[model samples]
Target chain A: MNVTTGQSTDAARAIAAGRRSRRWGAWYVTEHRLRMMRTYTGTVVIAGIGSPLLYLYALGVGLATIVDANMGPDAVDGVSYLVFVAPALLATAAITVASEEFTYPIMLGYKWNPTFTGAAASPIRPVQIVDGVVYSVIIRMLVNLVLFYALMVLFGAAPSPVGFLGIVASLLGGLAFGTVIMGYTSTLQEDTGQLAMVQRFIVLPMSLFSGTFFPLAVFPIYLQWIGWISPLWHATELARVFSYGYAEPIWLTLVHVAYLVALIVIGWAWSRRIAVRRLNS
Target chain B: MPAPVIVARDLVKKYQDFAAVDGISFEVASGESFGLLGPNGAGKSTTMRMVGAVSTRTSGELGILGLDPDVHGPEIRSQLGVVPQSDNLDTELRVRENLLVYGRYFGLPRKLVAQRADELLAFAQLEGKEKARVDALSGGMKRRLTIARALINDPRILLLDEPTTGLDPQARHILWDRLFRLKEQGTTLLLTTHYMDEAEQLCDRLVVVDKGTIMAEGSPAELIRAHSTREVLEVRFGSDHNAEVGARLARAQGADGHRVEVLPDRVLIYSDNGEAELVKITEAGLRPVTSLVRRSSLEDVFLRLTGRSLVE
Candidate 1:
């Protein structure tokens, strides 16, 4: 207990002489979170590459083969069946990745690990922590999109040069979905299987019913409203327009962009407010 | 005189109908080691959180570094370091990374943060363990890292809530030593603790809080001197007979000025001279299985003020 090398006092005084900068602290949190992400980089990369490849094979190659054979080569929208479904898959991948990034990790930030509290105690504010987490998740989404797109190109699923625009559409869809999940996470006091409920109820249902695997027109009109409300469908429609020049009215395309943008903006606002309130309390 | 680093005037924190902290007022001066001493749920932690600028007061005039917390929280927080009751270290980061990241949170330059991280690791006696994961470290190591991380920004004031709560005696001593060094370097420290010995060792001035109110406040020596006797004579005459002996001792003529407190396991006879008082008790034909005379501590003062043992 009395073990002293006398460096502590000198170090303490040195620290006392240290200076503070007014630079944005959220980037520091983002850097810290990014470092944490590195620990799971191997798994993240594998899953990023593997999931899209499998989905493209199963949905685009396998399912599309059967659908195209039944309906001819220009089956759904005068493009290959693989291309018709590729954009939707990209949007679904983004949403699912966003769901994973936002839910359990946000819960961990609040409950499991409480690393956010440590950040809150510093000069960094709660809003910055919220921003930092969202920013890092977006970074992850970008990487995931890159992997998904590379696979789409490999399988000849993405044909048009304009397909690169799907990247923006896919990322917007992710942010819109992720921010709301984050906002919900901030209100959680305990796990109690709420996240599992979200995955089972909200995420899975949205993925299945959001016209990811098939066009919304194929669904009965009664259930087609799900596609209208779901951010996945909005992004998928936008991505399809970009990916294969799938024709759509300009106003409808504007509506898709507007809906996803609205969700992102509102979700960002709510999550920031809730996170700051919870951290302050 | 310069304003104290922290001042709370009738601070209140309410959660629905229950008040975690009710109308408590206190001041902590610059470079002074102050404490909020109380058992768990007594609002010591709540008070620390408010002073740390993380928790808002329900209704009160509060100031940190002469700045209003409500109006200048970020600015005030920039000048303070806080070690919460629980270790909230980023378990995902290595020990050194923890310090570096915390420094970054203060918006320090990356190179400076790296240099400070090295120095801090050494100061925490964790130099060799810099690359070790926080989860892999011992409880003591984690605590030291937390303290080291807090100092990364050279905060004007350091707030610690139960800093050594779960540590072993050896670890506690090491932490105390590090805190002592920080104090010697003129860092203003505000800590909360249920440990009476810890308050005595660290705080130059402290307030005894109970049930969301300040029971008493003074330096350890002053508090003990003012509230408790110079010494205490503790005697156990079997748990069953303690109350009986206490009643007799209370009624005895010569022990009039002394205070006798009966406990479940023993009887405490408070007097200026405990040895002499014990002699008097022995002469009264009261034989005890065991007895000890020791100087009073902040624990005695807390018991005197609150009518309950510090631990209880």
Candidate 2:
């Protein structure tokens, strides 16, 4: 019995809704999101499988032969261009999928459709909603990254035995970028082309300048900052370290991990804070 | 009286300099059908949100089921069902899936939620809509489905914010019938509405609100009895002459007599016997364009308190 606030003893201890305090509330919201994503299962599957297959075939087989013939047998760091570009392509997939999951779909949950409010009306807190969304999108990214890695294996681009670790690297990379956008979207009361503007000005420029198809050193010094700051570049660099054993200082490798992790922590905290404020306001 | 299931004291909600809900207080006993009656922008929805434990009060003390909402928000919300003013149903899921998903949000057992979803679908008259998409349902069906979804967790209190705002007459009647049954079953129901008829039909007691403050509070009968006469006699002397005729009628009734209300189209004479008042008006040599006598209702009570029509 909390006498000061008038909360009853029986009511305080006897948590009622589905039984007690919501230990699994976040997972339940994740299940709902997964079911909603089921409506677009076809698109997810085709994009997951088709994008990797198409990109790998064109770059690894068709273009890699030209580069290998012109610049000698081992073109990049004594390895074929196919091996070097495959890891970047995998990280790029992570960023692309993360951006798509974080933008309009978030808009739909908070404004255009507002199913998140319906969830918030129950015992589920707003922070749980944020965690649930992150979990579901992480699941989607896992499946896609795994498929991309499998194609890299089939194309013989993954030379080292530990190249499968790139999937974990790419997953972190997705969260690093995705959660920041998720936090930003939670504050939108109404959309007046802001999200589309974000997609155009931020997402498109990120993939291009992150050295996806070429080495950052060839892009000159001033423009290299784009690669240095972009999550895609750090993730791609980290993935390249695993696949075909691309050479870099061990400390620089640790910096890539720390950078993506810092982004994830900051972005995730920002999202939870903003979601709770907006929903409880 | 039974213990109150909900209570609010000096509840205020502000958005910067603009106050959406000014200082107001109310209490609802167990199994009671309470309502907040007001026009749009009168703080009814804001009050509902605070009571539902979803929105934070700017300054207030609120207790739902004996727990402070600010402290035990998840606990209080778990026991309450909220039907928002707008339908926020998931368009991506099937109709029954909406119920199941919402029940799961409360962490309810899956098997129990499934069974209740079927029963609630039947109760909402959406028996065959288990697999139907939400977008396919009609307006009335969607409202019913929303109600059904709210009940999936078997909440002790149901909070409906303007439950029948956009429905047609037939749809409103059906929804009212369902609400009446929920009341009969001893569910503590709290609702907000602008329609006097809706208040008359559903609320056991209600507060008349205007401009973010409560103007009056009572049952429909008691409010009408206190603020209005037994009957009202409306005399239309044409819109052009309504003002001068209203002044002449005021003189006929005298300053101490019953009230004469001049609307844009007609003059309403509030008295015990409207027919007798009409007779007196005619004998006084005022030839009205038309006349009618009707019983006073909450509509008249609201007009008396706020000096504005309920629906306008």
- Assess every candidate by TM-score: 0.95, 0.97
List-wise, what DockQ does each model earn? 0.35, 0.60
**For each of the candidates, what fraction of the native contacts does it recover?**
0.50, 0.62
Stretches off by above 4 angstroms in model 1 are A1-23, B253-255
Cα lDDT tens digits, model 2, B45-103, are: 98988888789999977878788777778888888889999999998899999998888
lDDT of each residue in A40-156, candidate 1, tens digit only? 999889989989888889978899889999999998889879999888888888898888889988888887899888888776778889888888988988998988998999999
With a 3 Å backbone cut-off (N, CA, C), the pairs that clash in candidate 1 are none
- Model 2, residue B233: distance off in Å is 1.7
lDDT of 1 by residue, B91-193 (tens): 8778888888788887777899899889988899997998898899999989999999888888889999999998999999999999999999999999999
lDDT of 2: 0.88
lDDT of each: 0.86, 0.88
